[model samples]
Target: MAHITLPDESLPGIVGLFNFRPETTGALQLIAETLLRGESSLTSGERELIAAHVSYLNNCHFCHTSHASAAMAHLECDLSLIDDIKQGFNQIEISPKLRALLNIAGKVQKSGKEVKESDIEAAREQGATDREIHDAVLIAATFCMFNRYVDGLGTWAPQENEAYREMGQRMAFTGYVRYAEADL
Candidate 1:
C-alpha cells in the first residue's frame, strides 16, 4: 500500500498522483510517455538504462526496478547485465559512445553543475552527436526529479516479478507514454 491514498489507475504517475487527483496524473502521464517511453533517436534500451542508472544513484527503488526491467526486455540481455549496470556501467561491455553517455548521465544524477566540458568532449570523441549528449543529460536530469518524487511520496511498487516482467514486455512495445487500450 502507498503511504497516501490514490486511485489504482493513477498509481503509475509516481509523485504526480500524490493528491489522488486526475488532472495532475494525466499531465504527468503524458510527459512520461512522450519523453521516457516513446521512440527517440536513442534506443529504448539505452534510454531505459540511463533512467535506471540515474534512479539507482538517487536510491529510488521503484524507478530502478521498473526501468531496469524495461531495459532488460529491450536489450534482450540476462539479468546479470542489469546487475552489472547497477554496479557500474563504466566497466560494462557497451559501446564507447554509450559509456560516454552513461558517464554524462552519472554526472547529471550527481549534480548538473558537476557535468563538465570534459564529459562532452569524451562523448563527442566517441561519435556522439550533440543531440545524443543533450538527450542523455535531459534524461538523467529528469530522472533525478522522478526519483525524488517517487521516494518522497513513498509510492508503492508492485511486489511480484511476474508483474514487472509483464510490464517490461508491454512497455518494450507500447512505451511509457501511451495509455492502456480501453480493454486494458
Candidate 2:
C-alpha cells in the first residue's frame, strides 16, 4: 500500500501517483512521450533503456522493472539484453555510441553536473547526434525525479515481474501520448 490511499488498484506502481495529483498526468505524459517516443536517431527501446538504467542506479525497483519491460518489448524483448543493461552496459557488446550515451546517463543519475563536455564529445565521436545526447540526458534526469517520486512516497509496487508485461506491451503498441488503446 502507498503512504496515502490511492484511487484504485488498477493504477499500479508509479502510475498510482496520479491518484493524488491527477493534474500532473498530462504534463508528465507530454514529457514521457517527447523523450521516450519522440523522433530521434535513438530508438524507443534505447530511450527506455536509458530510463531503466537511471532507475536502476537510483535503486527504484518500480521504475527499473517497468521501464526494463518497456525497453524489452520495444526491442527484441531480449531478456538477456535487459539483464546485461541493468547489470552494466559497459560489459555488453552494444554500439559504442549507445555505450557512451549510457555512460553519460549513469553520470547524470548520480549528478547532472557529473556529465562533462568530454562525455558529450565522446558520444558525438561515436556517431550520436546532439539531439540523441540531449534526449539521453533528459531521460536520465527525468527518471531520477520519477524514481525519487515513486520511492519517496513509499508507494506500492507489485512484487511480481509479470505484472508489468501488460503495461509494457501497451506502451509499446500505443505511444505514451495515445490513450485510446492504452490501459496506461
Candidate 3:
C-alpha cells in the first residue's frame, strides 16, 4: 500500500502518493521536462547514465534499474555496459570522456564537496566541454535527490523486466509527462 492514498489516476507528488499535491507534481514534471529536453549539452543517454550511475552509487535499486533500462533504450548501446559499469568501468569499452564524466558523478554521490578541481580538469582533458561537465554534475546532483526520494519513500516499482522495458521505451520516446486528454 502507498504511504498515502491518492485519487486513482493521480500522479502523486513524490513517488507513492505521499503528500499528493500540485506543487510537488509540478516540480517532478519540470525535472522530467528538463531531463528529456536535454537542456544541457549531454545526450539523453548520457544524462540517463548519470542518473543510473548515481542510483547505483546510492544503492537505490529501483532507480538504478529503471534508469539503466532507459539509458539502454536511448543510447542503443549494449545493456551489458550497465553491468560493466556497476562491476567496473575501468576495464569497460566506454570512452575516456565517459569515464571522466562517471568519475564526476561518483564524486557527487560520495559528497558534493568531494568533487575536486582535478576531476573537472580530468574531464576537460578527456575533451568534455564546459557545458558537458556542467551537465554531468547537474545530472549527478539531480539523481542523488531522485534516488533519495525514491528510496526514502520506499516506492514499489514494477518488478517485471517486460514492464520496465515497456516503460523505458515509452519514456525514451514520449517522455515522463504527457498532456491530459479532454474529459468525456
Winning model by lDDT = 2
> If the candidates were sorted by their lDDT against the true structure, best first, what order would they fall in?
2, 1, 3
Clash count in backbone of candidate 1: 2
Q: How does residue 32 of candidate 3 score in lDDT?
A: 65
Q: How close is candidate 3 to the true structure, as a TM-score?
A: 0.81
What is each predicted model's overall lDDT from 0 to 1?
0.75, 0.81, 0.71
- Which lDDT tens digits does candidate 3 get at residues 1-184? 4454555423322444434554465556567657645466667777777788888899887677777778778878655555755785544356789889999989989898999999999999999998888888877888888877776755566654454675566667777654232210
Predicted structure with the largest TM-score when compared to the true one: 2
Model 2 is weakest, by summed lDDT over 10 consecutive residues, at: 175-184
lDDT of 1 by residue, 82-124 (tens): 5676678744457889889999999998899999999999999
* Runs in model 2 lying further than 4 Å from the true structure: 90-93, 178-184
Clashing pairs in 2: none
TM-score attained by model 2: 0.88
Off by over 4 Å in 1: 9-19, 37-39, 90-92, 158-163, 178-184
Instruction: For model 1, name the residue pairs that clash.
Output: 33-177, 37-176
Error of 3 at 78 (Å): 5.2
* Candidate 3 residue runs with Cα over 4 Å from true position: 6-15, 78-81, 90-93, 179-184
- Name the lDDT value of residue 119 in candidate 3: 95
Between candidates 1 and 2, the one scoring higher on lDDT is 2
